[model samples]
Each structure stands twice: as structure tokens, then as C-alpha cells.
Target: MAIASSQPNSPAHPWPSLVPKTGMIVTLLFVLLLLFMLDIALGSVHIPLKSVVAILFGNETGQVAWEKIVMTIRLPKALTAVIAGSALSVSGLQMQTLFRNPLAGPSVLGISAGASLGVAVVMLASGGAANAFAIRQLGLGGSWLIVLAATAGAMAVLLVVLGVAVRIRDNVVLLIVGIMVGNITVSIISIWQYFSAPEEIQDYLIWTFGSLGGVFGSQLAVLAGVVTVGLLISFSTSKPLNVLLLGENYARSLGMGTFSTRMFVILATSLLAGSVTGFCGPIGFIGIAVPHLARSILNTSDHRFLMPSSALMGAILMLACDIIAQMPGTQTTLPINAVTALIGSPVVIWVIVRQKNLRASFS
Candidate 1:
């Protein structure tokens, strides 16, 4: 009888190739840190980089107004953008992998539509009353009720999509169904808008434009907690996801529970997408485009590397968009969603056009 070998290059051990991957990881981390600092420092109000660091470290000798600007406005907005970007990008990657479609994303699948619907109900239905007395009676004062409604909307759509995905085997058909769901949600929102009061409609329109500044300091802890929990869940599933890349039957043969894994992915996507859309409005393009960007940069689909790289890339892209939204030259700030769309859409179209064998490779 031959003894099983435990040598470093044995079949079980394989050749250790950590050095290159580790180097890539470290490089990505450094780039992410640099981008984050730039995001915080380069804004409408130009503060010296050293002064920005000092303000962050509790050195209050700097200009009192500059400190207020950093602490109150730019820092929180930049942080929110980072969190939202990371969460949306990861969720999009998971959705694409789960559905095995390049076009899969929260907005495409009506997750954002669900969030919009929730906001519509709160702002249009509940808060539509002419008098303040009626608004108070409906419990729509602060943004909390709207957030709750949006969350409920997102979960509802997620549940529907999960059910559809299970029954529908063809990836193309599932993608179409997701788009139809989004259209249906848009129709609902349109009806609400038509009947909504002008004041309420104007408010809803502003929300639709999207703004990271909508999230206040008080709400940051809750947003961070939700996003952190969802991210951990996604990271934990990387191994199974790698197996899943081999197809459902192969994954099952490897002892993976396809149904449970799919359910968890749906749940995580819902939480991440729902929370961000609820707090920050239906941010566009980051989810749909960031994963592809990360994959193209890394030139590998291995989830172990892809997941974290996508997260950092998403954060960086989002922070950069936020910085752009605050256009340094112009007095008026642009909408966050518009900035993401302008940047993300061109990249997405380029990917579709340039990757000649994209569909064939997936098939």
C-alpha cells in the first residue's frame, strides 16, 4: 500500500502561489488607501492635506471653519459613498454570479424599484397630506419610516426574484424577467408621481437624483452595522461561490446545498442593496458596472480574489464619483446618481462592445 504524501508540491498541497496574489492584494490595498485620502482631502473647500490629517487626529489648532467643513460635511459624505459603493458592487457581483448573467444588478432586477416604491408610499401616500397634522398622523415625519418602507419593498422584490430564479433555468429569460419587474415598479412610481402633490413630487424627484449627504451622522452607525454584516456574509460564501462557478450540478456533486446557498445570496443582496437605496436613494451603475471593472483589472474570475478586489474598487469608484458630484469649480453640486451613471455607463457599453466573446465565454 502506498502512503499518501504530504509534500509541499503534492496533489493535495499544490504549488504555493501566494506571493503573486499577496502582492496584488497589497497593491490594491495601497491604491484604495490613497484614493480614500484623496477623496477626503480634494473637495470644494480645499484644505491642505496636512491640515485635513490634523483635523482628523483631534488637532484643533487648524481653522475652525475648515475643521467644521471636514467633520460635518465632507468626511461623512465621503464615508457614506465608500460604504454604499462597496455594498452595491459586491451585491451586483453576487447577483451576476448567482444568475450567471453579465447584466444582473439591483436596479435591473427591480430591487431599486422596490425601494422607490417604498419611498413613494411614504412620501406620496403617507406624507401627501396637505396639512402637517395629517403628515404627523401618518407617521412620516423623519426619514425613518421611509427607510423602513423601502426596506420592506426591497425584501419583497428579492423574495419574488428568488422564487422566479429557482423556477426559471435559462439565464437569459431570468434577466428579461428582472427587467420586466423593474419596468413594473417604474410604472407604479409613475402613477404615484402623477397623482402626488407638487411639493411632494418635487421632494421625491430630489431623492431620485440621489445624494450621499442624505445619510446623517446619527444614522451612520446603523448603516455601517448593516453593511458590515452583509459583507461578512458575502465573504463567507466565497468558497461555495467558487464551487458554484462550475455549475449547479457540479456544485451539488461537491456536497453544496444549492437551494440554501442561493437563498443566502438573495438575502445578502437584499440587505445590502435595500439599506443603501433606502438611505442614499437608488444609486445607479455601481452595482451593474463595478464587478466587471474589477474582473477586467484582475483578469481572473476566482471569487477569492475577485470579491475583495471588487469591494475596494467599488469604494474607490464611489468616492471618486462623490468628489466629482461636488465639482470643485462650480458652486452647484451635481447629483450623485447622475455622476455614477455618466462614468459607469460608458465603461459598461465599452465592455459589451470590446469583449467580443463575452457571451460565448460565459456559455
Candidate 2:
């Protein structure tokens, strides 16, 4: 691997700046598919991989319960993990690109924080009856409220950030401003918790822990649709994203509207990150950690390859986290957010050790 980097770029690779990242990306896609299948098949009940595949193909697994479990429970959870993972990862990639900061991510920019604030407002302000209200009022459940509120809050904060980004030409200032937004949003959430009922506080806190299984059925479809749209937006902006990699000045000299492109990137990011956070409840770290991992693995900053590669990696990581968190036969599950943090911290440390000039690497 070291030799590959030390030598001239491989001819088989399309991008001259790096090694044969195409093979790695293809390998990742295969791994992601395998993980997706495993996520559905390997659970507490221990359905066989064959049965799972059969169930997915609309064939009964000969056991009613097996079919039900595969179709109803595990399938949706797997799909949720795939979509959420891809969304958060791409969101992170976009933020990292736009900010030209390796550490930038959905949460770093306070978009997730804003989503948290929205959830806090609902669960806390509504008191201990949030669950009942979700099941009763609004007909579609309280989660609908949470999703709407979170998306609203995220979009609102994202808009403010974009407005500021439009006026300010400096990425550093924008980065600090994003941190400040997170701090402010978190402070507000803390105040809400202080005044809320203990039960309400507990409810909000639990939601903050994040969950992949919370979404299923129509909820899963909604997540998939929104994530797909966001991804499409991302692909559309890929060329501009690649251009911006040379820094805003270089992009502008190429007749690219850096500010407008930044706005589109933010919009795509908010949709992707906000929707996932809304449904999954602020699953963190992937948005911060995955892009650098992708860049390091792909050995290039080109968004063309980086976008899909990161999405595939993110889906695999999220599925792996879900598999671990579920604990299979244990009948207990850990919080998804905790797992992400645990997984992400090591990657972050590796990035710090591995990257000499992190910002310049992205550029």
C-alpha cells in the first residue's frame, strides 16, 4: 500500500492524483451490501441468510414468524441504517468541503444541535405525555411532530448559517460561527431541560441517545425518499464541489459562483443531515469522521468518487453499529449515538495522527 503511494499514480485509475481507488470503492460497495444483508438476517431470532434473501424476494420462508420478523422488523431497520448512514456521511463530506475544515460536520455546524433543540421543545414542552400524544393527536404520531420540528429547526439554523456564509468570504469565520450556533442551541436545550418535568427530561434525553429502529414502514420510506433527493442534490453539485476543493478563489476564477454553490451545498446538507437526525434522533460522529476516512481511502478529494464512496462506507459503518448495538441474542441494545462516538473517536484520532495539514489536504 505504501509502495503504491510512493510510486507514480496507477494508469488503471481514472484520477491521476491517487492510486486505484476504483477497486477500493467497488470493494466497499460489495461490503456494504453484505453488511446490509447481515443486518437483516442476523438478529436475536437468528434467521438464516437464505431465509432472509428469500423473504426479500417476496417468497415465504416456510415459517410465518421468520417471514414476519424479516419483513416487518429487521428489513426496515436495515434500510433505515443504510439511508441514515449515507445521509450523515454525505452531509459531513459537504460541510467539510464547504468549510474547508476537516472537522466540520452536521453537528459541528449546529444543524443537528438545532434538530435537538426542536425535539427538546416537543418532548420537554409537551411534558411526560409526549408518547401518548404521538399515538393520539396528529394521528400520524408524535414522531411526525419530532421529524417536522427537527427538520424545521435544522433548516432554520442552516438558512441563518447560509446567510452568514453568503456575506462572509472567510471559511474560518464561518466555522467559528457554526460552532457558536451549536453552543447557543445546546445552551437553550439545557435551559429547556432544567425547567422541564423529570419524565419529560428523561424522554428528551433518551431521544438524544438516538435510535435506528425508531423508523420503519412509511417512516422508512419517507427517510429513503428525502435522503435520495438530498443525494441527488449532492451529485448535481459534484463538479462545483470538486472545483471548490482548490479553494474558493480558484473556483471563482473558473467562473464558479462559490457563494451560490456553498448555499446549494448547505441546502443539500441540511436536507440530508436534518432528515436523518429528525428520524434517528441525532446520531453523531459519522458526519464528522467519514469524509476524511473516505478521502484517505480513495486518496483523492474529488467529489465524483468521494460522494458515492463515502455514502457506501457510511452505510456499512452504520449497519455494523446496528448489528453490534442490537447484540443479537442478548435481548438488549445499546444506543446508536454511543456506538457512533466510540467508532468515530478512534478514526478521528487516526486522522489527527495521519494528516499533517488537514485543511490543505481537502483543498
Candidate 3:
């Protein structure tokens, strides 16, 4: 948990600036707070900044509907965006470090793909009137079914990956295997889609597009609880993760439990990815892109800074994307997935091209 000092160093790869890690973290927190507030204030209804602030502080201001809007609708949605955003970002950071790849995230290990497959089986393959009861019995109710199914699917994929990783010693090989598993699951989903009813197919398609506004009450609890625990585990692994950056054998020589650390990381990633996918329907790009953004800002790979900064950066990105998805006026909301990909793809590309020593964090 050492704060990267502000003093300039004479290393082969000095940072572009002399800013302290604390400063970057503080700045990111400020931006995160502002973005979060904006997410709560700006929407189709368009509550004023003052009013939104006042409402949050328990000042009614004579508008009951506004209060309801802030508390019941916008608040939950914004929280979901933040929680899911941060969780996905950390998960991506872990994957990138674990596999030592520039482009790795929840999908890198096919957990989300498995979740999608699970939802497909429930909503598409078993969408008939006769099978509706069976679906509900499996916690695939009209509302939370997709969430549970996605979690189950992600866990299933995670378990398989863990089994393979235990048997196979190569990181590159494990990465490829994860991708292959995802492809196989997706192919099965396609087959399921082809034979499903039109409504079932449409439902599955909508889930893939993603929705942040659907979680609340018990669903929100499940999502929040799982994400919170996952984040704690992720944060705890910062030291081990940093050790991992120097390579496994080097870490092992230092007495770090490489296998146990990997298992912990995988478990945390599964919980974060699974819960978010189950509730939010596989929101993309933030997980894959935000870690690089954090590293570029801090100019260090230290997880102490990278983890919190990536989480905040992710929350900011998600808030902005969620706001854009809401369209800011009238009664229309675009799919969150499209907005994130539209924004995140360019940022990722720019980081790849603009940044020097993309693996500096590892070094």
C-alpha cells in the first residue's frame, strides 16, 4: 500500500509527470463524485443540479415526485452503474495482469459468454408455456431469472477454467482455452436461438444489449452484496497481484503463494463478473479498457493505485455512458452496451497508440 512518491526518478522509464499517486487518486475521486452526481441529476425528466443536491441531503423542496424519482429510480440506477462499473474494471485489471495481456477482461475467460448461454437456455430454449414453471423453479422467474442464470453460467465457466488452469501450467494456453470455451458456448447459443420462438429470441437479444435500470430491491441487494465482497477480495489481492507482475517463478521465489493467489483472483473475478452480468446483462468494454486508462494516468502498475484509480475511472466512464444511454430527454433509452462500446473502443485504441510502454505497469 505504498503511495508512489512524487519525486522524479532516473529509471529508464520515468513517468511523464512528477505527480504523486495520491494526487491522481484524489483527482479521480473528485471526477467520480461529479460524474455520479450528474448521473443522478440528468435524465429524461431533467432535475436541476441544485434540486438534485438538495434532495440527496434530505431537503424535500416541495416536489414529492422528484424525491421518488431520485430515490426509487435514479439513485438505484446510478448506484448500479457505479458498482458494476467499478467491479468490471477491477476484474479486467486482474485478467490483464494474470495473463499478461493488454486486452483481457471478463470475456477473456468466457464467464460472460457462459452467462449469456445460461440466459439463452432459460429464456430461449425453455420459453414455452409448459416450461415456464420449470424456469421459475430454478430462480429464472420473469424478473430475476436472467440474473440467477447468468451467475450460474459464469460460475460454471469459472469452475471449468479453474480446473483447466490447475492442470495446465501455461498462462497463454489457459487464455486460449478460455476464449475457446466462450466460442463454444456462443455457438451453442446460436443453435438455441435458431430453434426458439420469435419472442424468446427477441428477449435473449435484448438481454445481450444490457440494462442498468432493471435492478432494485432484492436484486439490488444480491448484486451489491456480491460486488462488494468481490471488490474487497480484489483489493486484498493488490500485493499478490503486484508480485505476479514480475512473473510467477519470481513471485514463487519470494515465497508468495502463486497458485492460491490465482485461485483467489479467479474467485473474485467470477463473483464480480457473474453478479454484474446476471444483473446487468454483460455490459462491455469498461472491464477491458479502464485498467489501461488508470495506468496511463498514474504511470505506474502498482495495484495499490491501479485498483482504486481503475475502479473510480470505471465508475466515471459508466456514469457517462449510462447518462448517454438515457438520451437525456423524452422517453427513450438506448442500450447501455452500445453506448459503452461506442465510447470505450476508441479510448482503448487511443491508449494503445498513444501510450509508451503499454506493459510499464508490469515492469
Which run of 10 residues does model 1 get worst, by summed lDDT?
1-10
Q: List the residue pairs that clash in candidate 1.
A: none
Better of 1 and 2 by TM-score: 2
**Candidate 3 collision pairs:** 140-145
Clashing pairs in 2: 134-142
- Tell me the TM-score of model 1: 0.86
Q: Which residue ranges in model 3 land beyond 4 Å of their true spot?
A: 1-19, 130-142, 359-363
Report the number of the highest-TM-score candidate: 3
lDDT of 3 by residue, 1-363 (tens): 323343547677665543335667778788888888899988889888899899999987799999999999998899999999999999999999989888889788999999998898778767466785565454322267677778889888888999998998778899999999999999999998888777678767888998888888778888899999999999999998888888889988989987788888888899998889989998999998898888887777778778888889999999999999988876898999999999778877787668865656544
- Worst ten-residue run, lDDT, model 2? 133-142
Give lDDT tens digits, candidate 1, residues 1-363. Answer: 012232466777675442224466678778777766676777667777788888888897549998898888778877898899999999998888877877788676788998888888777876425542354444431367767878888877777887898997654576788778878888988998898788787767877888788566667778888999898889877888878878888888999987778767777888889899988888989997888877766666777777888888889889878878878656778889999999778876787568644464367
For 1-363, candidate 2 gives per-residue lDDT tens digits of 443445445667644443455588779978998998899977778888888889899986579998888878888889999999999999899888888777788777788998888878777776456553663354322368888888888877787788888899787898898889989999999998898777677777788888888687788888899999999999888899888878889999999987778777878888899899898889888887788778777667778788998899899889998898888887788898999888667866787568644555754
TM-scores of all models? 0.86, 0.89, 0.91
lDDT, candidates in the order shown: 0.78, 0.82, 0.85
